[model samples]
Target: MSTVIRKYEPYNRFKGYLVENNIKQREVAEVVGLSVSQLNQKLNGTRGDFSATEIRLICKAYNISPLDYFFYD
Candidate 1:
């Protein structure tokens, strides 16, 4: 049997979206129900990744599709 590994980097996509859309980190954190500090930690790779629920909230708040994070470059 063989195992395959993939690099999943949604954080970078999220950051790019923020920059492109001119959305502030604090605004995203508030919409996703996280403290700005916690959001920063996740964005900076110091804390755990965003949960499925959090991702959904972010997409909903920003009117974006979750697929944008997973499928696009």
Candidate 2:
């Protein structure tokens, strides 16, 4: 079987990050200043996108660099 090399998908990576960190969606929603329902919409691609400030806030909340965690593939 050929191995599948997946290209980076931002939302998918974010979801994986939540899982890997054992974090609740509500917790992340709080970090990003979004309501749980709003976060769900964004994560599911129904909403537009996360603002830069929101992303920065989330990275800061987790004590991570946005460039390292988010901007990278």
Query: Best by lDDT, which number?
Result: 1
Local accuracy of candidate 1 as per-residue lDDT tens digits, 1-73: 8753323343777788889989899998998899999997777666777788998888887788888763455
Clashing pairs in 1: none
**How does residue 65 of candidate 1 score in lDDT?**
87
Query: Candidate 1 local accuracy as lDDT?
Result: 0.78
Over 38-66, each residue of candidate 2 has an lDDT whose tens digit, in order, gives 88777665676678988888888888666
Q: Cα RMSD to native, each candidate?
A: 7.1, 6.0
